[model samples]
Target: MADYTPNETGSQLFAEKMWLQGALITAVGYGAVLTLYVLAFYLLLSRLDRWNRQAHAIFLVYITVQFILATLFQASSARFTQLAFINNRDYPGGPGAYELAFFYIPVDMLGNIVYVLSNWFSDALLLWRCAVIYSTCRFPLWVIMGFPAVVMMGSVGSGIMYLLQVSTTSPFLPSSANFTIIDSSISLALNLMLTIMIVGRLVVYRFRLKTNFGLSVSQRDYTSVMAMLVESAGLYAAFSLFFIVPFALGSSVENIAFQALSQVQVIAPFLIIVRVSQGKAWSTSTALEITSASEGLGTLKDKVPMAQIQFACASGDDTSMPNAISHHPSVPNSDTTLTTEVV
Candidate 1:
């Protein structure tokens, strides 16, 4: 038998409304999202064609591992926390599978190990991609890419040390000091460096784009492509604030905080995923706009297919002949490479 109600202050750390309403709601929500992530990652692994195959593979693995951790963490947290809230709770009352799983917290540490390492691994992929994208002439093959890899090695090295030494009882609970601050500090530092590197890469990319393609997005198609980047950046920034800010501010280890941050961490990558999936520009609207306006120079139109332009050529509001020579902007190449820079 076990105590169901929120107990001593130390145990209150596990306390959350988990019985009838709140627990059920959380269980359903987390379960649904986790399922979708699993399916999506699998499908992506199957269908990734030209996208950075190396980075995509790393991303898929990362997502898969995160999915597993999320599944286990959700199940354990829900049951343990709900048991905390249930009346007349029981733990070791079961003799079969439940007991076996409940007995192996040390083994479950491997899941946590996967969780953190996968995070840094995915970040390393992004950091190097950005370095390549930022490089003006040829992508930086060794130095810039290797720099992030070294940092990743450091992060992983510290993480393994902390995981091996830490003494956690559950996925939600922090282990000893090595696991808590030592591992956490290293993670935060690496992630912070990653964030800065991403910003720098984007800056370098914009500069390159400006220097390469001119600072002005004169064409309508270019404007549409820029919109996608802007939107994704906003999504990225929002998710970053959710996790990065909390880590920087030293928030408490309450289960609610843990759950909230856990969810944000889980969903953050999907934002990036959607952005990558939506590659290339030249939308229908851009085409329509270009169609509505004459193509050619303002004063004298090009001798190609151009948009309609009416003129008051003293013959009333006479419609100018659909100039056979006037040119309307044509979407250059449909297969244009829309750069999906990782960060």
Candidate 2:
């Protein structure tokens, strides 16, 4: 047992309390994200026809793997909490110090590994989405993705260092702390870049639509603020910023953020998959259709008989309009309903 001043004992007690609070928050968040995961998974399986089987299979596998990782992480965290507060409460320097000292233990190490894996998978998904959204851009895919890919590799390297150091030393030690900060900074930077790219692409598309067609209700469905946030995984990025800042500062607030981060990571990509399954997510065909319509607006109006035009803008497995065009309120009501091919 090591000698501790009164202040040190008080600080350890506070840290233990914070850890318990963080664990509660993690439990709640895990339940909510699990619900979302299930819903997204079911929707994808049910709507296999929306996308190619290969794509659907890939998404299914990705989410399944993520789920497994998250589950293991949560289990490890719970086990550690049990050991720290219940099993080892009387450990020298209190439960909090016990947690720090025993971080290299198998349970805590498992949690750390899975946590890093979750970040990697989540970042990779965001990068892939950015690439898909910009696939039609003048720049080559490699050009746009190359830098972020390199940064991701750096994040991986730093993560490995952090893990290795934590396996032999306390994470609060300077050696492990440095790697932790580096890994987190790199991951955050990558996430922000990918988010900006995706949202920027959608914003440009929205502007083009508004400029070409004036204002239409259907256009909002595709490029609205809510759509942009969801598709870009902006929520995750925002939460990450909230967490990373405090974590880097060595604030206790990081405990809460850290606990919830794994769940949020899963939730972010699950939301995207839900949108894709519902045919509301932007796809290559959707982009091409919008571009064709915008470029040939006048021609379409002149060539197609107005009386023959009927807008079918319903969402969910509807082939009436390309994905993302939910409804068009711009068309004037007429006594005669007609059918015309969408441009």
Candidate 1: minimum summed lDDT over ten consecutive residues — where?
334-343
TM-scores for every predicted model: 0.54, 0.84
lDDT of 1 by residue, 178-269 (tens): 35445555555555565555555445544554554433343422333443343223333344444444444544323233344344445545
Model 2 weakest 10-residue run by lDDT: 332-341
What lDDT score belongs to each candidate, Candidate 1 first? 0.45, 0.78
What would the per-residue lDDT of candidate 2 be over residues 40-139, giving only the tens digit for each residue?
A: 7898899777658889889989888988888888898899999988898778887788887888999899989998998888988888888888888888
Q: Which stretches of candidate 2 lie over 4 Å from their true place?
A: 1-10, 49-51, 294-339
What number of clashing residue pairs does each candidate have, in the order they appear? 4, 0
Model 2 backbone overlap count? 0
lDDT of 1: 0.45
lDDT of 1 at 313: 40
